[model samples]
Target: MRYIYSTLGKLSAEQLGMILPHEHVFVDLRTPDKPGYGQADTASVLALMVPQIEAIQALGVTALVECSTGGVGRRADLDLAVSLATNFPIVVPTGNYREPWIPAWVHSADEDELFNWMLAELTTEIEQTGFRAGWIKLSAGDDGITPLEARILRAATRAAVETDALIGSHTIRGSVVMDQLDIIEAQGGSPARFLSIHTQAEPDFALHRAIAARGAWIEYDNVGAVPVAESTDLILRALDAGLGEQLLISHDRGWYDPALPNGGVPKPYTVVSTELIPLLRARGVPEDTILQLFHRNPFRAFSRH
Candidate 1:
């Protein structure tokens, strides 16, 4: 079976290989009052990241999905640069119409204006810069989708309908899952066109199964060795429930410097490549199963297949 990847505006075919669907090259956050916290210098990011990118390539990781959001330090120019430099097929989202994260100027503007701005960004980046982002990304706080965010979601759905792009999102927990989907579906969107990230953290299988029943892919992107047995078991149980095709696993680890003023987890790739996958292998998870979870599943989940 061959694999295809689309994360940073490029799609390429390759032999069936591992693909980490949720990750970041070097993401930094710029919260208020922490002016120096998140700075995305392309030269520096590429310089520091070349080795890690090469390492992933050498390890047979054919592609990656970079989930950098607006306030979370997303830079399309940098993403395009890395894709070109590394020749890695990536899918970056043309986003930011979501509430609380859309540019502050959007509040004064109508939803249509805000959405049009986001569309412009995505299209400009794709057509002019040669970046080919295939997904639309949005994030929600613990409250699920806010009013403004709902507008963003609708706009994104409309955009996806036109472009045939997929939708991927960050919903905090199980309680809000249905509500999140409500907005998407209201706009004529469905689970098949969406990826619900961090499903393993939702507390039970019933909730995940409910989501899958609706046709969305439940993403286990943040799973890792940390947080102990709970995380590991969450994944194992999900697979055991016969929901493998509906799942996509990743370690959402790459964004923090404990040494820096702010603290956060390291990159997801480091945890998966260095520790967790090996641990799972040592624990006797078959290579083919692991391959399907980390590779084929994600491709099918995000691609318009």
Candidate 2:
């Protein structure tokens, strides 16, 4: 039997209804270089985020995977609060962010120490929050996997294998997708449990085909930000190549930016159901195929069997 850990508690994978594979509930993307940025008040965040989640739930979305990790305003307690308020199950992650967002402590720690930290987050409660992470999140640069990022990736792979958790990597331009996979397999991690995020940014269909053939999952999650036609085209292309089982989709949306007046225009999470699904249907995508993308694939990718 397989199960997924939510901010609230454990849930069977089958119990996870229509899922948004990648999203951020409360993220402060502002950098240290810019002052007065990346500041989020918990009360303010919950005040705004709870209603957005409730709106998503009204659209029939039962669960969501919050990809915001350490170094990026990942408040597990806030996630739990929203989940409880909306009665929605949210699967939060544990790991480090990209090079720019990574903290100094991550650089000081050795690979073994990093692995232990991530392992503990998966196996136990995160930083006394009493909320265990459901999966591991990692990010690589556009040029390639940097040396430090490689250490994090290797450590994340080891932790994922030990915890039977999925490893979702943010691969900009999809340049290092294969390299990440190589490292994971080298460290005894299963490629089937690895997810290559932001694949739509990479235009190489052949490369996408190769990655899917290797038993890794491909995610085209920039829905609202990217043109719907282009996003759906990529999904259809992958499905045509018989990679539907390994494909995942989401808006990659949501952010309560404190910089902007009134939270910097919070993007709605309903685009997947309201806009994308209708577009896919208009393009002749069958209902069953759509369900597979929105439901079955996410369960298989995120569930620990």
How accurate locally, in lDDT, is each candidate?
0.66, 0.85
Among all windows of 10 consecutive residues in model 1, the one with the lowest summed lDDT is: 256-265
Error of 1 at 155 (Å): 0.7
1-305 per-residue lDDT for model 1 (tens digits): 32232534334344446778887765655441256544555665666555556777877777777787665656666666776778776566666524445556544667677567556655555445655555777776676667777777777777766655667878767667677778778877666777787777677679899888888788876655455345566667777888777788777755433224333334436566666677667766788888788877877766642
Q: lDDT tens digits, residues 1-305, model 2?
A: 88788887788856777999999887767554467656666778778888889898898898999998877767788788778878888899999888888877898899999999999988888887787899998899889989999999999988888878999988966548998889998999899989999888788888888888888999989999977887888778888899888999999888776677667667889899998999999999999999999998898888874
Residue 213 error, candidate 2, Å: 1.4
TM-score of 1: 0.83
Residue pairs clashing in model 2 are none
Q: Which residue segments of model 2 deviate by more than 4 Å?
A: 32-38
List, in order, the clash count of every candidate structure.
16, 0
- The worst-scoring run of ten residues by lDDT in candidate 2 lies at 30-39
